[model samples]
Target: MELKKSSSKQEEVEEIRTIEKPIDDSFLITWESPTDPKNPKNWPYARRWVQLVIVSVFALLGPMASSMVAPCLDQIAERFHIENSTEKALVLSIYLLVFAISPMISAPLSEIFGRRILLQAGNVIFIVFNMACGLARTKAQMYIFRFLAGFGSATPMGLGSGTISDLFTPEERGRAVAVMSLAPLLGPTIGPVISGFIAEYTTYKWIFWSTTIFSGFVFALSIPFLTETYPKTLLGRKARKLNKIEKTLKYHTEWRLEHIPQRKLVAPALMRPLKMLTTQPVVILCAGYMAIQYGILYLVLTTYPVLWTHDYNERPSIAGLHYIAPGLGLILGSQASGIFIDKTFRFLKKRNNGKMAPEFRVPVILLGTMFFPTGLFVYGWTAKYHTHWIGPDIGAAMFNVGLMLGWRGIQTYLIDTFIIYAASSTAVACCIRSLAAFGFPLFGQTLYDHLGYGWGNSLLAFIVLGSSIITCSILWFGGKRLRAMSDMVIFKDE
Candidate 1:
């Protein structure tokens, strides 16, 4: 009876979709009216928020999988009989390696297939492989399973920004993006905190199993929660429907251009992120900047266990609780920054007589830079001297405050700058940041071992300070000029 009612309801929707039209020659299939419910942008507040919540949840789970095992590394090393430090870290960073490459594929595939299918499909893939990680019999199995799970993880990271663009106008995007960005940003820091007590009390295998359980719940929720938000795909569906009834009806899009074969679109679309990374300085430089910040974050997270476990002699569960410091910073910073971002944009636009641009986000980002290195410096020295635990935690919190501010600003800038191509552009940024995340922790143990807490962390701080200042300044003063020069962006101040 439930199935019958659902099938009948679905048929009713299909009928409604086909109802509108005064057919004519060369009519473009678009929203029947500005208020059309089929249009994602026109969705009600309750529905849009539901979709956003689902995307954010999906986004969080992948990153959660990446780091939830942090407190259980010793157990994993024992089980796998791993001796080499690099290889041990590889067990953790290996997932991120696939995160770097998979988005380049997933983003383009979403462009072709639409966002809903790929995202839901990604959840299913993640569920299967993540479950495999729990049951792995060897190091080889662990590495291979982790690497495959990351492909599932990459979908939401790659395509989430495009979904935001689809559902909200530029003026309404800042808060939505903050919600989007906060999920993945805080996932790594919070994952261990949640899993830490579990690891202390139970087998490390629970990490993967519990995660799979949570993810399966999320996957069930996503089946009905998500919808296709890509405009081109929506319009294409409309065109197909109209064409079915009228034999002569033909709707045109860039995809239907005579010279560019349908099959050829796939290759260029797949390569678009790489092209943007190489040819566009704003993209490459901003991506590089974000990469540095992300690398530093993973470096700190991987090495944090060392600080507490060895130096401070804290239990694994207690050490896990310390992750809350950075996690809190992300939450507080994102909340405050989210509100200010839209207000700043609106203020800057008014001052410019109703002109709006990505550069408006630069001021908030600059404020973030001041806080990150300072946190690193404080965290380094406090740990080096073995001061009260609160000191280092305080510093960690401060650094993440800076991180949230800067990362959010850059993400919003990228979305605004590449609205139409947001998925591809964000994929480029995610690729670089994921690469950095993968490589950074491999050297984290070495950096701290050789230089000790103070100098090693100080070295990282200086690097972050330099990169943050240079890239942010360039984005502010010169971003407009660069955007004007890019073939992809059509900039108009007026």
Candidate 2:
């Protein structure tokens, strides 16, 4: 027993010494210089914009597929003999339900395999399952296909912001995030308008078919342009190339392919977002704020059919045209926010002697919060009194503007806060917000039915006003301190 103990101690000491030894300089992989051209951060402005445009287009296609079918839910319900209101709503809601869940898988996988492969493959999955949705004969089949398609569609949401963060620095990221984030919001709104026309002119199946073609186009463009941007991934490739060389060079990169873990860090990667969600107050508040916005957006999308077809006695095709107002609001708001967000951040940074904080973005959200309830009030009251059709449209458009502004603010904040883990952080935000989006519409018809648009939306406005005030206050006064308290990775300087 004494001899064995001594031998174990000697082995332990040797192991410790081995670990303490410095890694050879040759094995160390690093950028060649501060201005290395291969680094995404060093890419030319035109090239960076080209990458962003490609990603943004891919981003738009997924959500377009998700909500384009909104206008066809009634036709789907009648054909499938779906009588239960919840079941009818489930046809749409279930897609969102899966959307909330799939990011758990997709976001972490993107981190492991790099963004391009997962994104392109996920789009393909989305294409296949979404097309299958059109062919679904039974209610069960529709539910399954929609869920699977949603599972696939969620990849862009999970990964797109990370891609933006990869290409742009925090100082330059605001507008890029705005463009990437706008895709999902804009896609849902634009979808129903097109679907309405298709619903009027062609079979509902064409909706799925048309989107498939569009997504295919986006996918083809992505294939050639969406290069791998993950640093470790690029280094791994470099290391592999070095190992393949037959001659031993006197001077060569020290990076070793074997140093990277053979097994994917699956368990820890999967748990990170949930861990952040539970431990970080900033994530909770921002995610909750975004969720409310998403819920409201979907609520409007779900009820447009009811509002125009039943309340105003408009033809379905014309009713679909009304979605254009909100779509315009989204575009204008996003564009305006993009232009201003960077300016806001820069002006604040300059005031503080060139230091920027995530809290700097909160003021924009304050403006949005005010617009949120005011627009709701305008929309709800106008629809209640049977005013001019344009009244409700204008109100809805205002609400969308508020939504886009708030979304842009929070999204930029999240990407900035969780810079290294942007994908995972975004996935968490998307999860809760997607849940709100899923459940909100399930109860939308009933809420409007019981309370009327004026009172119902008025109640929503009050709740939003209260929540916005609280969110702004917390982030404004305590955001930096709260970030300090958490163990999550945060950049100390922009």
Candidate 3:
């Protein structure tokens, strides 16, 4: 028997050969053919886009909730009798703490159980606990509810990236990953804007309540529409279905069977993200740069309300509107990255004998390196001197544009590099960035207090500038070599 290759360009579905196999034999169960409709990569553009939209919406909810409370931290602080900046920031940062932790568990589990279940379950958990956050009367209740809700929120962060990896090929992933990623960065910006007005006009509790309500609608949409896409899990299901037909006879359950003892699979699956983080240079550098970018983004977001409300003497409502500046910039970055990343990949692929490596994604971040620090320098100094509000907003928009480009580039590169274990690789990145996001804001007030906005932000800007250089150099000059040495297969476009 001869092995059949995929027609779409990569050997993505090698197990899914054209020739049929006996389920009772040792052959692996897979899609019927290269063009099998069941294969998500082969899904029609319309169908895949629907999945992208649903997951992106689910993805948006988590990061949105993470920062929605930013505009209303003061209101909550007052209600709970909290008196310190750290504690006030705790109300927001506690959510991010778990946001860093849950992806390790969720991403690995998605590899085991499938993506749909994790996405839906996490959303339900978010809806219930988020509503509880709105209902909480004490700081204790709010903290617990927020932490649990964060776990729910972050589940989609890893799941969404894995889903995009499952649904799109390396060539088509630029646009898909851009949309999937826009949620987390863009969500924070969108969140504060909505909550600022709600907290000013209505009760601060409405912030959680409104998101919970919107989450309910998105949850409902996910229930009927979202389906499993993990190639391994789908193969397992297909094998089980075949097994039921004739129990007395054997099936080709030996190949990629899912009946492995949970004891055996769980520990390794859960550990994979940590293992990669410690062992893989590509993962470490991608996550490191991303963490710096994420940390600074949250630091700015947490303090944005104060900048406008205190420095500019604006009301909470008007202060909240400033998020739109960064929000639009984030959109601009994502759109621009989406447009050029694939084109760049194709151009590079042509230059390199019609083969594509994950390193092709790194060039977009070079543009990010330029914008991120410049925006930081401008925003920092302008806010320090109390320049017109528009000056700071423009600076914010510019940095945010950099944030999106850098973030999308790294995320898509990881997904492409570790195609089979995309979820685990993504979890590693999420875990690191979440930690940064959590820690950065906790010290943001103190940093600004000591150094003032200009120097403090400039410090962050310079750090990211340095990190971007290391990130680009490694990926551009050494990414292919690093990936070649990796134990996992490095997917390439042919």
Instruction: State which candidate has the highest TM-score.
Output: 3
Q: Comparing candidate 1 with candidate 3, which one achieves the higher lDDT?
A: 3
Compared with the true structure, model 3 gives a TM-score of: 0.95
Instruction: Give the per-residue lDDT of model 2 (tens digit) for 146-255.
Output: 89888887888888777876778666777897788778888887888899888888888888888888888888888777788765456556655665573333323332
How far is 54's C-alpha from truth in model 3 (Å)?
Answer: 0.5
Q: Per-candidate TM vs. native?
A: 0.92, 0.91, 0.95
- Candidate 3 error regions (>4 Å): 1-3, 11-27, 253-255, 261-264, 489-494
Off by more than 4 A, model 1: 1-26, 32-36, 254-264, 490-493
Error of 1 at 291 (Å): 0.1
Cα misplacement distance, residue 313 of candidate 3 (Å) = 0.2
Error of model 1, residue 450, in angstroms: 2.1
Q: Write the per-residue lDDT of candidate 1 for residues 1-494, one digit (tens) a residue.
A: 01111221322222123323435524655556445688786788888889988989999988888898788888899999998888889988999888889888888777777889989888888989999999999999999999988889778998888888777766677788888988998899878997788778999888888888998999888877677888778877766666666764466433453224447678878888878988887788788988999999999998898899899999989999999999998898888788878899889977987657889988878888888999999999999999999999999999998998888788888877777578888889999999999999999988999998899889999999999889878888899888876777533444
Error of 2 at 9 (Å): 50
- The total of clashing pairs for model 3 equals 5
Candidate with best lDDT: 3
Q: What's the lDDT for residue 366 in model 3?
A: 92
Residue 126's lDDT within candidate 1 is 91
